[model samples]
Target: MAGGLLRWPVVLCLLNTLIISPVRSTVWTAGSAAMTQGTAVVVGAAAVSSTDEHFVCATLDWWPPEKCDYGTCAWGLASLLNLNLSSHILLNAIKAFSPLKIRLGGSLQDKVIYETEYPQEPCRPFVKNSSEMFGFTEGCLPLSRWDQLNEFFRESGATIIFGLNALNGRVPLSDGSLGGPWDYTNAASLIRYTVNKGYRISGWELGNELSGSGVGARINADQYAEDLMNLDRVVDQTYKGYQFKPLVIGPGGFFDANWFNEFIVKAKSSLDVISHHIYNLGPGVDQNLVEKILNPSYLDGEASTFSNLRDILKSTGASTSAWVGEAGGAYNSGRHLVTNAFVFSFWYLDQLGMSSLYDTKTYCRQSLIGGNYGLLNTTTFKPNPDYYSALLWHRLMGPKVLSTKFNGTKMIRAYAHCARDSKGITLLLLNLDRNSTAQVVVDPGTAQLSAVKYHRGGVKEIKMGEEITREEYHLTAMDGNLHSQTVLLNGKILDLDAQGGIPVLESVKVDALQPINVAALSIVFAHMPSFYAPACV
Candidate 1:
């Protein structure tokens, strides 16, 4: 829990009617919820951790590609990617943004970076820098991009695990012959520049989706293993001059249990982290599809897959973490625009909550912008439905995932976190049902609660374009278009409605009463009053 004085209005009349044998317990604000929640709350009270309790959380995995407009990449470079109306926009959104990892993809790498001309390809209007017609020909080696990348990592607290080009034209030859005339020297130079510029990159992946489809030069499992080994040696030698030997990232493709096992056995030492991708697209939003993506059983399946890989790595004396590098809702254009609808929040939230369980080091989404899979709309640079979900997780979901329960009907999904900063304990509750408001009784066991602030809205409608509130204040709406803002903090009525285009909600200073009823299909961000409050399981 973060330490900050939170002031809230005392709903005197309201509480008087609702009071029922509630003990006047004084809550003690304490430390990180990540550790404290599991240690003092669930383990101490519920006796959960003592048994088969597990901790699973999500992390970013994929590096979103930059969209180019006549050679200039747009997206978020102009300004903040909040999709709000602003006078000045940025040119390179990727510069300030820190992606979880920069994946040098295996299959898509050829299409995106090289721009090679493929025969028998679907006919479409020809466009330069388009991966559709030409692959590997579009120069991806821009020093400016790399420089911006270094700055991004430095600014946005993230590490880069760069992927080496391993597509049709980028793979290195085992023999001492440069058969493809590919200039790996350029790659070496960029790496050296990253080190010289003080970029914090420690891992390098070879390729992605190499085995599936017509990707990767079609190397067999054993041959691919040997190829990865040679590439590892070459990469080390190339960067040795600069005293930087990054851990090799490899076998980034779809989940192939047998192939991964064999490859791990053959090329264990050559890799540092095994990479894979998972997309849950099972024909529309039917029960089967939702079950495949959200059911605990599916997670169990994924866990089994990763566990087998880990065992194989252990058997081969190769111990490294796993990452879900490129993924999104259903993969192909994200099941159409419906993926951008606010309803997808539940899915995103579930993914984050479940990442730690899978032991995933990082879980990257496919595209930050562009494609239906993007969290932000590529045309207007506005946040899609998933963006708000991602932001909530990023802002509220602390390092530690605290144990919690729904109490009543399981319609509401809640995940609490002890904050690293001294901002009191934060509770993120997501009500997934679109049609019914969820009445919840929040029992932060033993911890005396003081104040709470909530951010809530309808779960379906996603507002687009710039918004100006009643007060003419300029602001942006992410996913849930907030409405009828009303806030009272510490007995002081805050004028927090529409003001200068900025939409306002309840005051952050107000204390909330217990037995709160959260609206349906809504995401409520509640912050307790106290820097380090007592443990609330």
Candidate 2:
């Protein structure tokens, strides 16, 4: 037995012995219960809709300016720090999933003041404050800095959705309405400068969390709608003869039923996309982070907001679609290891699958870098577990979302999509069960199953004929440490190559007829090359 173990790779051997040991006996029946009563999931070929590229978007915040001094700041930190947009590693990571959308705004966005004169000192530090939203007083983005940012966006192949300040020296009236017209002078100047410099921004979003009663300050729906129209006029006038007009998106804030309904109804066709933010699990300090992420009911609860927004748009006769402009599992930074670790993939991927079902055109993550929930680490810029998950979703899952039905417990969630630029379907299987392993049988409608099954004890023989090809990329942590940022694909850790290039994704090929053993607390992305899903083509 010891000699036989040496035949396989060290990683595979370790995985078999340490991680997924004690193989359980269970038959996963695909189609009708007559074949076997085991757990099963059927993936349908019918396409729901063309997948939205903006579905996988991220953010570049404008807070805690990267190069701060003591009590003052310049060149908002995210522009100078967090994103090394020019780095080979960063660029390569981004290019791996090209055509990425990045939202450049945050709480400090409303506080930012763009200066045409180049600052003598680019960045200064401000007094450290306990409140996450209070340190923007020192924030300034000079023209030179903006130039650098635009160039970086161009090189990174990113579409910029910039947020303009809404509360710049504005006040509320006696009845708590916007006292005067929004002070768009500072914002307009910056937009005009960006256009003059030939920056290709894709969309212009106004305000940050100023939609519903507001965050720090409130803006009535009527006033906010007027502000949106004013911004629309600014866009039309500024780029009158430009070849491509940027999309006008607005009132970036949380969703309140009445507030959203009124804004959409009043804004009418002025807004291009309805944008909103979500932090479903509350704060990062919550000790029940793991429990919350693993619960299907808890995850599905966010769907109501999406459905409501869609209904609102339809009822209001607005042409815009919904976009989750910003969403992190938790607010105020994030739990150190929980948000960045392999376990976070459960929440992140499920959100992607759920959002796509509700016709959400785009879903931008809270951040690409900075904060504990970033896809990449803030200091080292190393790809977190969620980073690899995002890459795989981009590479394998196509724009066409397909329907899936699983007969097992809700602990094992399933989502299907047409394989990107391929002739088959990709199934994303997430096993959130922390204790017991689950088995799944993929049903390719009406086709006869034929394949060989290899197990630890011996090979389980099955009818064989035409090749039934299947490939899987399983993500899990080493040493059973759910908090560890390190991720293993298949049975190997994904690390940088000797030359610092991104590691290639390792996929394990299997027969479609065999039952797939989904280990506890793991994610499995399966690609079936045989079943030709018409939507993919």
Candidate 3:
């Protein structure tokens, strides 16, 4: 150990491994022994991944009170139809980011009917029906509700991406698939209405989980392609003379490489983004939820999905973006206590770090506020632990992602990027091991870590005016309880104030010479202002 000790921060996330294959194999390539008991290692940083400026996004689902999973009515008024748009705390949470992307849709998106220009059936709320598709009869979104949502979005300065119903005109067929060309008449009317009203929608997504065998209902790739072309035409015609138009996003479902490649090859350039969903942690009701969160091998399973998606997009030569349309680690509204706890940060932040490496354009969490996976509480509307993690990442991590690799202990995952604001780079070190502490060092391409035994060579003289102190935000579970909804920064509880305002995310300044020590199961966001990176400039 050197004179300055670097205590290991606790960040326990199974990772977005840079490997391939969606299957969860218990084989730990990086050494399971080290995962169980931490190890000393070096993190090398260089290169930059192409990532979008708006890389962080969260979803707002339309699941009504009747929607239940595992015998629990997890959703309580967080739907697009009933969310309290007047929540001041919600407003502040969105505003705290200066600007945050909100994706409005979910499983019921395909079931939604936009009542812009009323016609056929009376526009009404969804009525639960076990005999019908998705366990509910058809639902309607009156233009009045649309108006309210738009107003709230404008007030929050949120970037909006709405999911439109793709099953509108199609007839349900055999094997959970839909048949027929999409009747764009009503949908076009809705889009035109949104345009005429001047509601700023960043993107209008086509459907939800309607690909790769589908979740509720599947659509043929060929037909879906035609539908995408139909959608593009609708968008073009609606924004005919406008200089800027909302983006056309689609096929939000779990990654199915063949389905995606076929859709891409067929859809051609009509698609702006090839979106997908992630529920890699399995059903939310799994008993070993915590074990899965702590296991390195399990987290590594998702890499194949991210890796294959990247390759597919590149191979097709289609100029489109790749976004994780929606991801809630565990499906079925996620585990009540686990998904909503401080421990979920391990999974959430890990996904953020890993997806960026694969050049993911945008990542939309399963929820901003809905179900157990929401960033905010379902009823109280208080911010969750993952909310703070997202906020810190947005505030400190810049769009330019630097290539980072750790040489030891899969228990400790590493990610680096240009600082969100400043003249340097930021490194995020996560320690997943709860019983063991891993000592580690960083290799900044511009300057080497001096006098450390693990230093990989390059050393530069310390400049006089350089910022010698590092700003570190240490995150851990309050009262050492991982299931606690509360979070701590630098050992202080993070709680919002009255009147629904977000609390300041403060960091502690440490001498650059001090040793970087991460304790068991903690998270450290280190902003190295003095460390130089060419990509940042």
Candidate 4:
């Protein structure tokens, strides 16, 4: 028995067998072995499947940023801080009172920037007359709703951006052909009500996507300028306490540079933010095509459009910051698989990184939840792949940007974040490639890792209820092919993969060389465990 205990017979053997055999079999199984002892033969075994499939690592970057709140948020004062979910409308109606600041708004304007979302949903077909529209309006929150939403924003550490109804609620089209002599009363009332309720409205957009009217109401640039200018005057005079007139936003979609330039020149000093939208997919495109569209470089194209606008704004001396108020997947519902899949993590991370370079201060995703673009799923209120991705970014990325570089031939992208917390710095890596893997470097510091966590999935289409497959998992961060073989730790290659993950040397100095990898179609975040200060890296 003593001899048997001494010779444990390699309790667990690592087998690289394809476990996708009989569908009924589980991927992991238990195994046993018999060891010959001096007195007797003892049988012992262990249950082991490949547990090293998902890989993630983090290193401390000497530079860190000020701690700030960052994460996936919704549109307008109401959504930024609160979820409107409720079994009863009246009960949920309380959401309007708690308002959050820094919301993303303007669906009507989305059309002008994207040349879409212009055609308004024909008022509920069931509404036979004004009474029904009133009933529907009662069920829904209108301009008055902003009062409560703004309160929530203030209490929750956020601000408000109210999307006005430039398309409906004012002009009655005998044939519904975009008729409005202009009703500053309701619009003016909205601005006054916000002030009366003591809610600070950071910006008040004229109309959402009025440039093309694809989904809402299409109006010429000149016409939009007129409406915006008129509304600007009323809001400015009525809310003098605001110090500045609410920011007027326009051209919500389609990258309308011509319209943006024209509006800037004609409506000088009137509009604060030149809003825009973008969607990256061709309808009915194949999976391969979708994967190609999810590339980080694609962001470069989107950024270029903003760059052109930024240059124009600088030339015109416009003071308003560029705000991506409304944007998400191609369809109202997200991409069939791409957006909902882990692939979105790469896209989102790049967005945060690029926003600073392009001088964009604020970026509002389409929805917090609801529509495919929402950060949370409407039905489950559970975080989606994007939600988890947002959570990591919010928790790690701080107020200031840090310097880091990425050199790669394939698609696994990387970004580094430094903050003044004991958790050390975090390196974010995304394996955008649906099939191939890629490796990364993680610089180690004095703090050794206390723990590690990773999120991975198969292909880009693995939907709800499906388990990620072993092949897919392994392919995500497969050693040499998908990751860099020589991961330098404090300047030396450490055999960390023997256990699988980025290594953290205990009691190491602040600047340590760390190597990490991003598995295909996965998001990897590394958290350092120890004690330190909070600052911008």
Top candidate by lDDT: 3
Give the clash count for each candidate.
Answer: 63, 14, 19, 64
User: Of 3 and 4, which scores higher on lDDT?
Assistant: 3
- Candidate that scores best on TM-score: 3
Rank candidates, lDDT, best first.
3, 2, 1, 4
Candidate scoring better on TM-score of 3 and 4: 3
Q: Over 4 Å off in model 3, which ranges?
A: 1-46, 118-120, 173-176, 445-459, 463-467
Task: Tell me how many residue pairs clash in candidate 3.
Answer: 19
The per-model lDDT (C-alpha) reads 0.44, 0.73, 0.80, 0.43
Q: Say what the RMSD of model 2 is.
A: 8.1
What is the alpha-carbon lDDT of model 3 when measured against the actual structure?
0.80
**TM agreement with the true structure for every prediction:** 0.60, 0.84, 0.89, 0.58
Stretches > 4 Å off in candidate 2 = 1-45, 65-86, 117-133, 174-179, 444-464, 532-534
Candidate 1 RMSD computed on C-alpha atoms after optimal superposition onto the true structure:
12.3
lDDT of 3 by residue, 175-216 (tens): 668889988877889899999999989898999999988987
- Model 3, poorest ten-residue lDDT window? 23-32
Residues 1-537, model 4: lDDT tens digits: 000111111111114222222122121101113111111000001111111111111100100011111222222222322345232322221122222223444342221111112223321111113343212221123333344555445554445566655653345445433555445555565566667767766677666555654344555666567777887787778877656566677656566767777777787777777776655553323345355555666655666865787788888887766766665645334543455444454566666555544555555665555444555444444434554344345544444333344555435554444422423345555556554434443322212122211111101122234433221001111132212212222223333233222233221222111222333454555443321212221
